[model samples]
Each structure stands twice: as structure tokens, then as C-alpha cells.
Target: MRIFLIVALLLSVSFVAGCSRRADDRAPGGRVIVSYWEKWTGFELDAMQRVADDFNRSQDRIEVRILPVSQIDVKLMLATAGGNPPDLAGLWTFSVPDFAEKGALTPIDAALQRAGIGRERFIPVFWDLCSHRGFQWAIPVAPAALALHYNRALFREAGLDPDRPPRSLAELESMNEKLTLVELTRTGRVVRLPYAQLTPAEQRSHAFMIVRAGHLPQEPGWWLDLMGVWFGGSLFDGRRITADAPGNLAAFQWFRDITAKYGIENLRNYGATGGNFASPQNPFLSGRVAMELQGPWMHNFIGKYAPDLDWGVAPFPAADPAAGKDTTLVESDVLVIPRGARHPAEAFAFLAYLCQREPAEKLALGQRKFTALRETSPSFFAAHPNPHIREFVRLASSPNAHAAPRLCIWRECQEELRVAAGNALWGMATPEAALAQVQERVAWRWDRMQARWERVAEARRKEWLDRELP
Candidate 1:
């Protein structure tokens, strides 16, 4: 009886001591903090935070601290340059290429290989963009491709069936003409699609019109893709850009004709004022516009802001049904490891896990986000009731989905396009002049890029040749 009592007393004392030690060891709890930077805001941000919360709850080794950065490129560059980068980050795919080129990113291939993950796990085009100079750089999280979002109310009111949307670019033009309304006031002020003034429908329309006129390329090797289908010519010979090719000029001229006939307000300063897309005042939501070329997220915006507004989803009208084949632009959000991160291994492990199909789908659902890593089937979408939400996944999986050229000058390229379009819309330059200027700028940038690559390639070759073979 005496011995038992002594043993119990000893055990009690030990337990107390252990508890005290744990308490003393904690400095705001023994949480290993991992800082994460992401560009998503609004509902998109909530979704990302949920993923972080889930990951944190799943394990105890590390706690993720998410910082929502609005200007992703600016913040990320500053952090990297300052050598105090976040342990993990979420960035757009285009942003990753530049980071990888500048050595601001770390290669994650070793971690991916260790985890037995492969490129086959993600959508091919998204995966392709993450590779820079023969190294895997980042893990893809969400993919959003360009699709069609149309106002069904307008179609029904126009005495047309909303169920049947435009299938080709020609059909879209015909529908636009039918849906267009020109209300001229007694004061001689013309108001077309009065509701369009309520929202940024004109800007949205301009982007689609640019596509229809074929100013953009469908692929890197093709002559401007938008033109190849619209004007019937390729933009490249595989060796150089053929933006000024005969077919391309015709396509640009056709696009200029639209601006010449209509007012430029539709193209410029149309959508710049709207703060949020998911609002009742949205031009498309208000039924001021008949059609839109946007993404699946627009459906969510409508559900939250204007559920009563009838709408339908469709593929973006093809420039030329016979020639365009089903071209769609594929873009994605990715997780990148900044250079000189403190715990790169752990960061990459978490990223790799999230990039896998099952967990990715779960994270996606919980956050209402899309996945760049392709899901196995409809199991993920089947769980969600809205069919429109699945449109991005469907289009992303389609054969027509393709990534833009993985050039380092991609930033300049996008800038050129934006400026050219702006100038054309503002009446400062005709479509042909704007495009010709863009071509010239592109040619100069390409030359610089080629020179840079040649220098790097030559050095690498020499290094290999100079080394002794064992």
C-alpha cells in the first residue's frame, strides 16, 4: 500500500512538471510560422485563406501566415530583392516566367521528384509555362480560361432563344447587329444601348471585337491567330513574327472599320469606372449588352449580385469556324518559391501536395477556385450545383486551349497590345497603324531577346566543352 502511493505521487509530479515545461517553452505557442503572399482579393481571397487554414489545421509542424498583396509583381519583386521573401507565394503564371528568368525563383523539380509527382498531373499548357530554361519552377493552383458569358434576358427579349448562342464569329456579328439599339434624342445626342453606359460593356465588347478582327495569335507559331481565322492567313513562318503579313493587314483593317463606323467610346473608358464586377449595375447584368467574352467567374458574380438576371454560358465565338478550330486562351494562378526562402523544402512540399488532383479539387471547392492541375473527372464539379462553374474546367481541358508564347518579353508584349488597342479605340491611330507600330516594337524586343539567349547559350556550350570527360 505504501509503495503504490509513492509511485502514484511520482507519476503525478512528473505530469505536472512536463506540463510546466511545455508552457514555459511556448512563446506565443510553439508555432513555426510560414509567411505566404497571394494576389487574390475579395471572394478569391477568402478561398485562399480557407486553403491556408485547412493546411494549418491538418498538421502542427508549421502555421501559414497569409498576406494578401494587391500588386503582386511589385510586392514580390521588392520582397525578393530585399532578401526577405515569403516562404511561399501564389502568383499568376505569366509572373512566374519572369521571376524564373531573373533567378528570383527556386526550382522545385527536386521536391516534385522526391514526392513522385509528375508533369502529367497538371493541365499540359499550364505546366509548360512554369518551365524556364529546362527547370520546373512553380506549382500551378487555379486555371481560368477565356470563355463566353451572355445575357439571356436580352436574347429572350429580342425574340430569340437564349439557349442557342453564337457558334462562330460571323454569328456573333449578326447577333450584335440584331441586338444593337440606336436611340437618337431630339437634341441630336445618340444613345446606343443606354444600359451600356451603366457598366463597362463597351470595354468588354472591344476586347471581343479585337479577337474577332484577329489581332491576337492563337499560338506562338501561327501568324496572328485572330487574323489567320478572320482574314485567312498565318502570322508566322515559325522563325519570325509575321504581324504585318498580308492577311494580318486585312484583319486589322476590318477591325478599324468597326471603330470608323461606330463611336470610340465603346472601346475606351468603358469599364474603367466600375469597382466591382459582381454588382447589379454591371452592364451585362443590367441587360445593356447582349453578349460578353469573359470567364466562368462571371456566373458567380451574377449569382451573388443579380441572381434574377437570366444568363447563359457558351464558347467564345470563333473567328472562323472552319479555320479557328476551338481556340481558347488558358491562364492560371501558381505557387512559386521565391529565392532565398528560409524553409524552401517545407514550402515546396505543401505546394506539391496542394497541386495534386484530389487535394487541389478539395481546396478549389472550399475556395470556389479553379485548378491548374487537372481533376480526374466530373466528381469535383458534380459536387457543385452550378453547371456554369464547370465551364472553365471543360474549356481548359479542350484541345483548343493553349498558352501564349513563353517569352521573357511577355510583359512588353501585353503592354504593346493594351496600348495598341487603346490607341485604336481613342481614335489616335487606325487599327493598321497601331498594329504596325506593335509589330515594329515586337521585332525590336525579339532581336534583343535573341541576342541575350544566344550569349547565354554560347557560354553554357563552352562550359560543357571545356570540362574534361571522365
Candidate 2:
């Protein structure tokens, strides 16, 4: 807790220091200067800058100045609360609900319509991510979808067909067993175990895939939403919390079963021993891990560090063969217009320009990200760094694609869920106990947030009424 406070203080100080040197409200050329705060740096910053430059060149009315910042969520929230926000901000998709609910964001539905952009213009799931409750709060900039990446060499070594990736959970388990080599010393102590070990992000992707495959239930609560959807359960039937729904319990049990089979201790040990993920010695790249669920960005790492490594990308396998084949988890970075911006219209103009097919493609190509735009030129596919770009693009556009849960307390819920999941995996808590605790804690938080929201709404209503009457 002390560490968290210190980090928070540092972030606040950094944000204040950064904001002290504000950009001119108007450029020397008498153009409206739109301040754009983005959480991108280095190469990603350069890519966005290029897009900004293109927008500037395309018009003389507005000049978009991009500023990259660290701890963007913290800075953005502080700026909004201080009533000195940038005209536009690039934020994570999960921020939509909180920002919108807090009245920090300007709904973009009107702006989008004014700019002649429609829901049809973006990948559906990406578009949905921009909305919270009933209003559109952001625009997708760079989207990523999850897929299964397998080392072809490892498959061949296991005497498995390299071309035939697992199509069902059973097959995936079988392949995992065959691919995982357990070496034992003369004393019968285990030496090495090589298979799939997912990071937190990868686990989320896997959970979503299982939910999409109809193997688990999905509930309205972010933690168990996937399972609730699968089991026709609703975490909130619009009036109250239902975190301990029967389906959610069943889902937790399934999670426990999978963790037990995978051997939680083995996974923990393997992860501890794995090489740096950003380096060439990464388990997946070093052939220490046979398979992984990852995004298109993994292609960049493989191409740069392991050029000779033969690999294959496929849709994450379903829990059952009868489940749909193309389901995937989609996530994206989004641009939002914060409330109290000095130039909302001009900021949106720049945003709309960036959303154009050409500019969007250029940005995606520069960042090695999948384009958020629904359609792309053939040239984009041909020149994309990822050879399997089409596969990701297809998944992005698939009707079955789903985004992370949209809730004002999504971040907190996710954190609690992770803690519970870890505890369950380690046998510190039964899956049932962990999930019940999460449901209760998150539901309590949600109730408080909702009450605060209602108060804020009432205050706003009264303020507007007073203004109109006066």
C-alpha cells in the first residue's frame, strides 16, 4: 500500500510537470491547435505522429499536436477532474465505461455522425467497445485479436502433424500431453516440462475463447460474464447482482478442473524459469514452450528474433468440435474526446481524418497492429509484417468476436478475479469460495458506484434545470 501511494504520487507529480508546459491554444499560423494526449512512445509515438502529420497536411483549419505520456489513465483522470483535459486522448478500451460514467468523456455519437462515420465503418466488436451503457464514448484506433501460435518444429518432434492444429479441447489436451516432455533424473525428480504456460493476458484470451465456445456460462459480472453467456446466466438481471449464480459456480469448477490437470505448481515453476518474454530466449521462441495463445504482435518478435523458426497461427481451438470455429477475443486502443475540451469539433475532425482507410492502414502498418477499419486495401495485406495478418483480420471481422466486459468497475473486477483465480490455482481457496468472494466484493463496489452515479446525475439535472429556468 505504501508502494502504491508512492507510485501514485510520482505519477501525479509527473503529470503536473508535463502539463505545465502546455501547447499553444492556437498555432502561429492561426490554426486551431488540438492537443492530443496519447499513451504511446518510441515507435508507436512516431506512427501516431505520422497520422497526425497527414491530417495536418490534408487541412489548413486545424493543427493536431500529439503529446505522449506515461501512466496515461492516471494523468487523463487527473486532467479531466482538474477541468484541463486535452482535446483528444488515446485510451484503453476498458476505460470507456468508467470515463463515461464519471462524465469525463464527451459522447462521440453526435461527433461521429457529424463526421460522417458510422458503426459500419469499424470492426463490429471494436465499435461495440467504444460504447458504454447506451452512448458511444470512443473510436477504435488499433485493434488486436487473439489466436493460437504453435511451433511447427515442436509439433514434428512430438510426432504430431504440424499442419493439423488442434480443433477441439480434447485434441488440444492430447497435443499438450504429447508435446510436453517430462524429464526425470535417476533419483526420480522432474527435470524439465515443456508445454503451454499462459500469461495473465493469454489466460484471459483462453477464458474468453472457452466462453465463446459455449463450454462455460456467461454472467453480466465481468469476472464470470463469459461463463454466464455460455450457461444462459445473467450476473445482473438489470436490478441486482447474481454473482453466485449456479452457472457461475459450474464455470468456476471447470476452471478448477483445468488448472488441476495442467498442474498449477508445474505452471508456476515453468513461468519462474522461463526466459525474458521480450528476448530471443523467450520460451515460445526458444522451443521451451510448444504452443501459445497470442496476438499478431508476436509475429514481429518471431520475425526479428527467430527468423528460422517455423511456426503456424490458427484460431484458438474450441471446447467442443460442435462449437463455432472462428470465435476470438478482440481488444483495441481507442481515442476519446474528453469533456471540457477547448475544441471538440476540431479534435474530432482530426480523429475522423485518422479513421480514414488510408491513414488507419498506415497507422496500423507502422505499429504492426491490426487495422480497426472493417476493410483494407490488398496492398495492406501484401505488405503487412505479419504473414498471418489475414487470419487475424478475419477473426476481427467475425460475428463471433467479443470484447472485454464493459463495466465501470471492470479494472477492479478483473484484478479481483485474477487474485481469486490465482488462489484457486494454488489450492489456497476452493474455486467456489474464490468466486463467491469476488462476486460479493465486486457487487458491493458496483452498488456504491451506481449510487454515486445517481447522485451525480441528479446534481446535473438540477443544475441544468436552474440554468434553464434562470
Candidate with the greatest lDDT versus the true structure = 2
Measured on C-alpha atoms, candidate 2 has an lDDT of: 0.73
The TM-score values for the models, in the order shown, are 0.77, 0.82
TM-score, structure 1 vs. true: 0.77
lDDT of 1 at 98: 73
Angstrom error at residue 7, model 2? 36
The per-prediction tally of clashing pairs is 8, 12
Give the Å shift of residue 349 in candidate 1.
1.0
Find the 10 residues in a row with the least total lDDT in model 2: 211-220
342-439: candidate 2 lDDT, tens digit per residue: 88888888778878999999999999987888889989988888889999999888766765567788888778777775566566889789879989
**In model 2, which runs have C-alpha deviations exceeding 4 angstroms?**
1-23, 186-255, 262-264, 458-470
lDDT digits (tens) for residues 392-421 of candidate 1: 777777776755556666777667755665
Candidate 1 pairs with clashing backbones: 214-226, 214-227, 217-225, 218-225, 223-234, 223-235, 223-236, 224-235
Worst 10 residues of 1 by lDDT: 211-220
